[model samples]
Target chain A: MPSVKFIEHNGTEHVVDGTNGDSLMMIATSNLVPGIDADCGGECSCATCHVLVDASWVDKLAPATETEESMLDLNPDRESNSRLSCQIPMSDELDGIVINLPEFQY
Target chain B: MTNIVIIGGGQAAGQAVASLRQEGFEGKIDLIGEEPSLPYQRPPLSKAYLSGALEASKLLVRPEKFYQDRDVATHLGSPVKHISPQERTVTVGETEFSYDKLLIATGGRPRKLTLPGSDLSGIHYLRTLQDVDNIRAHMATAKNLCIVGGGYIGLEVASVAVTLGVTVNVLEMESRILQRVTTPFMSDFYHQLHTERGVHIHTETTCQGFRGQSGKVSHVLCGNQEIEADLVIVGIGIIPNIELAETAGLACDNGILVDDHCKTSDDNIFAAGDCTNHPNALLNRRLRLESVPNAMDQARTAATNMLGGDKTYATVPWFWSDQYDLKLQMLGFSQDADAAVLRGDPGTRQFAQFYLSEGKIIAVDAVNSPKEFMVAKQLHGVAVSPEDLANLDVDLKSLVPST
Candidate 1:
């Protein structure tokens, strides 16, 4: 199982083991994380599974495609490190990665 | 005074700007949108907009002058490329505009198929005026249309296509149409209704690719079946625009995560509409809804918070889709409902299916029954005895809140 760390807006950190091929959004949702809604079920249709990749892990994550990029543009707090967790499939390479949860999702 | 800037030309952004002004905020308002025309309603784009019953000009939520009259600096056709939260500014091409508060209502884009022959001349995805124009032109000469998805957009477009003497074929990858959003009973009701109307629906069908002639789509290849088509409308779904949010340093979840107050990680910024994910009080969980009601409701909540007013948005989720002569209205989340009670005849296509969980009304999907829908919306989350619901003379409205 791959593992990832989730850091909340208030600086709380949670480390969880993730299933392979499961999206970061699914990991957070399955864990009942307060954030990470994943409303559109990882279809990239909804931005509910947005997360900010830790600066050090930014290069480790894949770049967003046109569909993901267009969806991110609709987000209010778009930033350089923002990535929709649903679009980021979990793998061994993403182990030990850290993500910051937004304060609110809607 | 706070300087608030909103991006996107849609109902959500327009409502946010107007709500801000209505709330007595004397802040500088700048509405930057990529659409060359004024903000308009998109639901009609797949329905009335294609039927010629609604003119493009009338689709505008408010006239062009309405923004100027309301003291909003409107920037039509301008798309924001970057955001500097540290500097409280957004850069659109060569122009850099500053803001104390920002709202992103960039909305969504229709998903386009990338299969072979997808770039063919007759293939299209409905998202904007340009797509609508192409579809309208094709409608004039086309006789058969193959819709790739059986969701709201596909069904609504089929409704219009059938009315205009066009033969329609809907392909659904799932065994039943609307399996993701609706109950099995509701799906059966709609399936029967469409079948009776001479519409051919193929379930459990997977599209292999498209066959084209002279750069124009001529057939949709699904398994061993070749569906002849003059036009193909793909309504797979939409992706929310979150690139700008990700480019900035804000925290993002499935959407720009906001608390009950609609504030993102940054206190100075907010997100609403289809680009946000917030907790649904009624569902007792977090969700991202794409309906117009959710968008408008969240925009108001974001606007209020931007003006120093803290208000938590907690409304029951509801959605309505019109197809042919049937109007399907659904309320609450039915994903977990264990039992569904039918209130009318599905054969007639005029009924309501109430989804129940632990003897509580969790959701309701009504077809051509506005009265039942009205009652169901009020009965959401309420503990109702199944016996009382089955009784035809019982007035459910009497049990709801006064307000």
Candidate 2:
């Protein structure tokens, strides 16, 4: 089973087992993890589920499409590591992924 | 601790609860939801949920435990009878709950067509979860579904029906689909897409009445033409639920009117989401928006003011719709635009149409082109000539002025 660690802005961490077909937003939210709003319900339309990927695993994740990049650009606090958690599909290869939820999301 | 009461069981009310908890408001939060279930997403009620691709649990804004854990008392399936602003109490039957602050997020209801045979057994309107459940149940034994309206709801249902192998016929009174909300380019794009999917689209046609058999809708009458239909779905429009605000002596127009801070006429009361007619400084006009983003954003603003924090909601309005794998994202309002420019070709199924008023970008409707929509959202009211926009060499990112 794949596991993803979600770190909140206040340093609270929640490591939950991820389902293969679900997005990170879905896993974090369904597990009652705080700070992942998924206000648009994993539609990739709202960037509220914005997360900063750990620097070490940035190269391993799939690159965001132009549409996803547009949504990320709307976030004022967006950095090179910023990704909409809804766009990242959970898989066995992406286990042990670490994502930092932004302060603005709360 | 203050007693904060929230009315309505839709996205606005649910988001308000989440916002209050996120803001650390440890008050006695009372959520009065008219529906039996928890606050769920309405958008999927027509698409994924209706098609059975999305589960009912996924539609909830938050799990039931979230509210229970926060000590937020929830009253589901209870309709608020009346509100007394002077007494600061909301009445649900004989029970009266006092509140220091109140939020009215009643949202809206679907407008029903009152034609002759409108009360037929097989006719349905897509608004609530129950409404879609009824439609989904009917879809099992129904074929040749007739949809009356070409708006987002109508089109979304048509998409699902087509996927379910149900023959669909869409009747639009307007000349094109989405005439009231989108540009002709977008309308034509969707028209072509749906037509290619084997859905019959009838434009400039009005459903005069329904022809029924045994109190069930069998066919639809449109100016002497009777189209066979085993089931019928109406998605005309919605009327904001504002009777409570009006009865409470708050100002009401087409919807409950609110200022920039989401405060109503009375200081103790606040209104947000689809039930609100709010002033948008960016658009330089007042309008009511029905979208998830609008509901969530205004709920945040209303929660802030409810907690004694002054925050104004003046962001650019944005909306999105998913139909047959195409995602259309619109930014700002495009009403009364003088000119429109096509940024890309619709044949490719990914393009954007920029709406400009007197050489200034007012709004944009992007089809699977989120980058263009993002650029338009940032430069919403900035003056940019159509010629400059048409130039392929010029980057939309460069047009955005750096803060």
The candidate that achieves the highest lDDT relative to the unseen native structure: 2
Best by DockQ: 2
Q: Where does candidate 1 stray beyond 4 Å? A: A1-106, B401-403
Alpha-carbon error at B372 in model 1, in Å?
1.5
TM-score of B chain for each model? Answer: 0.96, 0.96
Cα shift from native, residue B302, model 2 (Å):
0.5
Local accuracy of candidate 2 as per-residue lDDT tens digits, B144-190 = 99999999999999999998899999999999999999877778889
Candidate 2: stretches off by over 4 Å: A1-23, A26-39, A59-66, A73-78, A89-97, A102-106, B385-388, B391-395, B401-403
- TM-score for candidate 2, please give it: 0.91
lDDT (CA) for every model shown? Answer: 0.80, 0.88
lDDT, candidate 2, residue B392? 58
Q: Give the TM-score of each candidate.
A: 0.78, 0.91
TM-scores of chain A across the candidates, in order, are 0.94, 0.95
Candidate 2 chain B worst ten-residue window by lDDT: B394-403
Per-prediction tally of clashes? 41, 0
User: What tens digits encode model 1's per-residue C-alpha lDDT throughout A6-106?
Assistant: 98888888898887776788677545454665443444544667798999999988899765675465455667898889888899998888999988663
